[model samples]
Target: MPDADRPQELPARLLTDPEMINACRLRDFARVFRLVKTKAGIYPSMIARRCELTPSRVGEVIAGRRHLLHMDVIERIADGLRIPGHMLGLARRSWETPQALVVTEREAQQPSEPEETPSSLPGPDVDSILAVATRTSLSPATLEAFRSSIEDYWRRDNQHGGEPLRPAIVGQLRHVVELLKEDRPPSIQHGLYGIAAELARLTGWTYFDARQYNQARAYFTEALHLAKEIDDRQFMANVLACMSLQATYQDKPADSLALVTAAQDQARSAIGTTPRVLSMLSMREAFAHATLGSQARTHEAIKEAHRQFERIGQDDPDPAWVSYFDEPKLIVDTGIAHGRLGEAATAEPLIADALRREDHSNQRGRAFHAFWLARTQLDQGKLDQACHTATQALQPASAVASERVSGHLKEFYDQLAPHRQEPVALAFEARLREALPLVSGSTRP
Candidate 1:
């Protein structure tokens, strides 16, 4: 028989991995197959061929449609995937490598540079919210309830990603619109408009994160209109900033720049705007400039953002949404901007530092930043290290359902395709395959 036709041995590290050991112990064939398929580049057909099973049967096992409980079949899987029998609670196979030799070989291949360093790393129920919105009054108390709910939504979006909350957000937004049509005092009327704008913007954000660009744009436009109706420049600036971010993602750097400029103009004209708000706008501008390949402008914008950030005072009334743009966000955004300009060396440390400083509960944010960090590492030719960094991203990414984070992971995987055969790449691929179901099924708006 041709040596190449035989089932290949998996790297020692992969077989020794706690996750792999646990899956094998639990007899989770689906996970086992996925790991083998991903790590070994052994497709379903290859697994079937090696195990003397049908391809459909192997597919069923990987998809959790079938379980291999029979000892014969289990032994076949062990041989087919080259898992050490002891790991699966079976007697050691005749073909198992000698322990001393395995240890020697593992040490020979182990990298001197360790896996990527660690980075470190909320809101509301919907029922009571609807009950309050159902009340037909434009009372200040009602306004405050909606306002508090909006803040909660923003916090939820921060920690959990916005995809799951879109339905409740839309319902609340519609209720706010209905209240807007009723007669009320001038102050209350403006307040209602503000609330409506906030809801519309939150609705847009959920769509944005889901990559539903058209819907996001429409909601953003609605938010802008509501803000305009009350002449609320600050809120209008916030909406425009959101739109600018969408434009950046869409690759329309010029449009992003234009929108951010408009946002800045609004901020300058508005009374009581905080330095943090300006700082956030500047960071957005830096992103646009970076995308445009305008190095000078990007640097200038980033510098200004830092300057504005340093001026933040306790008395300043920063809107709750912009409050998320703190030191870590600022640092990560700067790193991302440099990454866009292909300066991975300059970007890596900032991103890594941001990760360490970032709030652990902001899982979605961590996922996004972690992806950027991995990309920068990849750009710098640190393929193995990059894969390690990316692996760290998966833990947080899994906790929240977010297409934005999923898309980032997808983009990184696509970029890593060229080096697919590398052992570290193979290992990361296996882990990614295990996560594909969750990443691919991220909730959409």
Candidate 2:
């Protein structure tokens, strides 16, 4: 039915192959080229022709002699090959079929992942979805795609910080809002509302990280409204926890404690709640108590957090966002809570051990923890070691644009002012000046 010499659309088998997925995730183009050739029978020349690249360049890529990083080039490959944008860490592409139709149905211009999507594999056949007509309403597959995209958004935010990601996230959030305007079934509406709530909360988090308190509050309020619309208590707990943290940043520990209390209440009866969720809320409680200067309550909350963590079973399913709140994070948060309570001696080792165990791709986390480690060292009066540790932090900070990290550094610098004449402090000063000039919006938060 098709020309033997012609390059057919990539088979779904190749697209869904785990190896190919990993390669794409890593942006290993050389491996991608090889896979396309071996698995899809699309040779280098054909690949080049379809992707609008020179044959030699394609050959070089296949041979592992070249790499592709430019956005324009990446887009061309995606468009030319019909690769789903999520596969490439991109927003859904322009040519993707509308996810849902009103009264009239139309042919789909694209095929996407299935319900639950596997970061999932079992779904309708790719060719059928690629060639089949539209649905009257959004399907579970569509929701899965949205969830997948959101997961990627959070991953990128964790690794790279949120400022660079806000535009795409906001665009998707707006699209989800527009989708809500359509008359959908209650199931679909709730799903859409939950996603919208998450996006709003994430937007608020971005603003919070940037120290834009007013904007953060506005978006957080909007997220709460959306979460309430669906009676999604789990989601509500998550949002309240975010707000609780933000309140602490704003130096309102009493408000933080109240918010965390509400979060704990919501989480208690929330369906499908995981131990990690309970543990995280307790950590939030601990943070609030620490900020309030109640050492006894802080220790009690921290113990509760650990108790909840010990209850975490491997089979305990958590919300994707909660995945970040794992063992290393719990340890670091404990150290941080103690540090906030001015117990530097109790904090330093926990923070240091967690840092060593943290995932390297999480540059922002590394930077944040590194600052705390440095601060604890400084508080223990280890001037030279503290300066050295703080200097090391600049490596991760340089790789991400986070106002929180910058602000913490600024606070540390101010603390070092009395020691400015010392060589270690001067050396740290030179490095800081060279690395960031102290990004202007930085704050103690």
Candidate 1, residues 112-184, lDDT tens digits: the string is: 2234544441112354476566765557888898899998988888788897787788778776776665788
State how far residue 91 of model 2 sits from its true place (Å).
26
lDDT of model 1 at residue 102?
48
- 1-445, model 2: which lDDT tens digit per residue? 2568443678899999999899876668898888988988888888899889999999888888876743446667877777776677553555554546411321122122222546445354663464345535798888889999988888888777897777777767767876776789889898998888888888888777776665566567667777887888887899999999999988999999999999999988878788899999999999999999999999999999999999999888788879899889999999999999999999999999999999999988998899999999999999999999999998888777777778787888888977999999999988887787434344322
Candidate 2, 324: how far from true, in Å? 0.5
Worst 10 residues of 1 by lDDT: 106-115
Clashes of each: 1, 1
Query: All predictions: root-mean-square deviation over Cα?
Result: 21.5, 19.1
Go through the candidates in order and give each one's C-alpha lDDT: 0.83, 0.82
Q: In lDDT terms, how accurate is model 1?
A: 0.83
User: Clashes in candidate 2: how many?
Assistant: 1
Give candidate 2 regions above 4 Å deviation: 1-136, 437-445
